[model samples]
Target: MSLPLPLIFDYEEIAGKFYPVIPIELKVNEKRFLTRAYVDSGATFSIFNAEIADYLGLDYRKGDKIYPAGIGGHICAYIKDIFISIHNIEICCEVLFSDEFTVKFNLLGRAGIFDRFRVCFDDSEKKLYLYEKAYSDFR
Candidate 1:
């Protein structure tokens, strides 16, 4: 089933812009949060705040530590496995938990869940379309 991506407005700009944001449920062990996440195609991996790890009983300092770069710069983080649910579809994937508070919200990225679906963004209407893809179709 195809789903719509709810958009959030960024009032920081002159007129501000809307970003495609969707409701997602993140699960780790017994901890879970139903939060909003931005869909970012440029990002290589899903990124979340370290607070989530801490809330989920993870050290947030362990795991495979590495540096990931963004438009602002690079930051150090640890990779961990997490389960995310969107549009009633759930999947387990690798996610980066950054200790720095620079990341204000969770980002849904290509490597994690974005690659699993066909996505389309329509700025005129501020709408996003997502469709789960068949493995054979990608092959």
Candidate 2:
């Protein structure tokens, strides 16, 4: 029902913050590699680092183009269907990738990943709960 959220601590900043990160496996051309991604409920689209696009054999610029802006500023990215594996469950998800995307962190947003799973984040317990939902459940 509840799973521990992978977190990292930083002491360089005056006030340290807890980052909810998870190890997700990316599958491309049947090749698999493990990577870390931040779970964000507020993000409109999930985005990954450019290196992953290369590893996945994606050109990163030829797909559908979209300019997304936020507090970090504007970034140009291409939308592509990416295969992601988490907790032994695999899903084909739409993700944005760009050379300018920060290589330091990958984001798992609310669109593709949230469509299939019910997510609950509890700061008190520092846990993320995920439940699979059937097609009929949403209707």
Candidate 3:
């Protein structure tokens, strides 16, 4: 079975806060899990909460330490490889693992996943397309 392409929603800023939440289904260790992740173009890598990794039975010890920061400050995180799929497209890449105190869901960043796909934001349709290649070749 194939998964549908990602649905992109227009990010709106409330007060001075920017909310860029995107719905995503993550496949790890042959297990499927669904959650909403914040799409952050500014981030260099994708990150997932430790609780999610534990629930999915992902091996935490295989990960390496990486430092990431939020509004509060910088924190040490673990980075590991996982299989990510969207719209029948699957790719193996490294993702960051953070303790529950940091975040709840995954954070889709610029490297790994996003770098592999040609992404287009259709403001008119309010959808995000992850093209196998470029937008012109997308079906």
Candidate 4:
């Protein structure tokens, strides 16, 4: 099935440019938080601010630890399974929570999402096409 997601136009003062952001709901058991996240194909794993995990009352540090590096430097993060709702489609996946990731937006990356859907970014239309793959499609 093909699901087209409408992106929210977010303007960044530093870049003076607008980018497409996706609205997602993060949930841990009974707790749920709605927020916008950058759909980044370059990122290996979905990463969220530690504050979000705290908001969900998660003991984030108990998860596996890893140091993910970027242009700025490496930062500590913990991997944990959480449910993400995109367009009301809920999926449980592993994500990283970090205190040092101070970016303005959370990231929906390759690990969990890309593995399940074929993502097409239509920059001109400012939208994302998420095509859900059947089990046979996985090689």
Candidate 5:
């Protein structure tokens, strides 16, 4: 059986817009882990704070420089590949790595997850729905 879609919520109203936390899982090397991450559609790439990366034991190295919005001006980060999971659905994708000292939470950007899933937000129900396009027609 396929996994059910996850509920979405308005980021602004829920987490004051700075950090819109979404419940999801991170899968790596065939292992699945659960964590709540911030959904940042504005971000061109996904990111994981240092703590989360270390916790997952991801062997990541410094990649090309990336400029991300920060409290001051823009913050620089590195890139790496990680398996991300949501509602039991897992997909390995490239992600940015940064120290938690700069960012408040882990960010889920538009690159990987949003590319494959159709997202719907129900304001009335305060839930966000994520549907895999590949499985949309399957009954």
Candidate 6:
């Protein structure tokens, strides 16, 4: 069965331009941090700013280090397992935290989120639909 939730795209003003963004919660142990993220289909992994790791009291340096090149060039990131909550659906997955990821928005990429959910983006109507592939993480 599909998850009944369909998220509306949130418009955020960045440098006088509006962009569609989504709200997501980052979880580590019992700590949760709510933040806005960009749904980036081109990204290979979910990546966030390292400040979030500090907020979660994580020693982010302890995570697996990696260098990923993107349109903006290469960046250093650390991979850590954490629960990412979008609305009520939560999934435990690997996410990268980077001090070098200077973009204003964190990225919800293909690896963890896309692999677990069937995602549809409607730009004309500004809507995002996410359907769960499994019930394991539905709350």
RMSD (CA, Å), each prediction: 4.2, 4.7, 5.7, 3.3, 4.9, 2.8
Candidate 4 residue-wise lDDT, 1-139, digit = tens: 5444432343322375555477889999999999988889999999999999999999999999999998899999999999998877677889999999999789988887887777777666655677765666743
Preferred candidate (TM-score higher): 3 or 4: 4
In model 1, how large is the Cα lDDT of residue 87?
A: 65
Span of ten consecutive residues with least summed lDDT in model 5: 10-19
lDDT per residue, candidate 5, 1-139, as tens digits?
Answer: 6755554554445434333567778766756568777676677888877666677776555566576775677666777877787766666677887773366667788877887676775555655667775654432
Instruction: Name the candidate, 4 or 5, with the larger lDDT value.
Output: 4
Summarize candidate 6's per-residue lDDT along 40-115 as a digit string, tens digits: 8888889999999999998989998999898778989999989999887788878899999898788898887887
Query: Against the hidden true structure, what lDDT does model 1 obtain?
Result: 0.76
- Evaluate residue 14 in candidate 6 and report its C-alpha lDDT on the 0 to 100 scale: 71
lDDT of 6: 0.83
Give the runs in model 5 whose Cα sits over 4 Å from its true position.
1-20, 30-32, 135-139
TM-score versus the correct structure, for each prediction: 0.82, 0.82, 0.71, 0.84, 0.72, 0.86
Residue 73: error of model 2 in Å? 1.6
Task: Write one digit per residue (lDDT tens) for candidate 1, span 46-82.
Answer: 8988877888887767789989987788989888888
Among all candidates shown, the one with the greatest TM-score: 6
Best of the two (5, 6) by lDDT: 6
Please give the TM-score that candidate 1 achieves against the real structure: 0.82
Candidate lDDT values, in order: 0.76, 0.76, 0.69, 0.82, 0.68, 0.83
Give the CA lDDT, 0 to 100, for residue 14 in model 4: 34
After the best TM-score superposition of candidate 2, give how far the Cα of residue 62 lies from its true spot, in angstroms. Answer: 1.6
Show the colliding residue pairs in model 1.
Answer: none
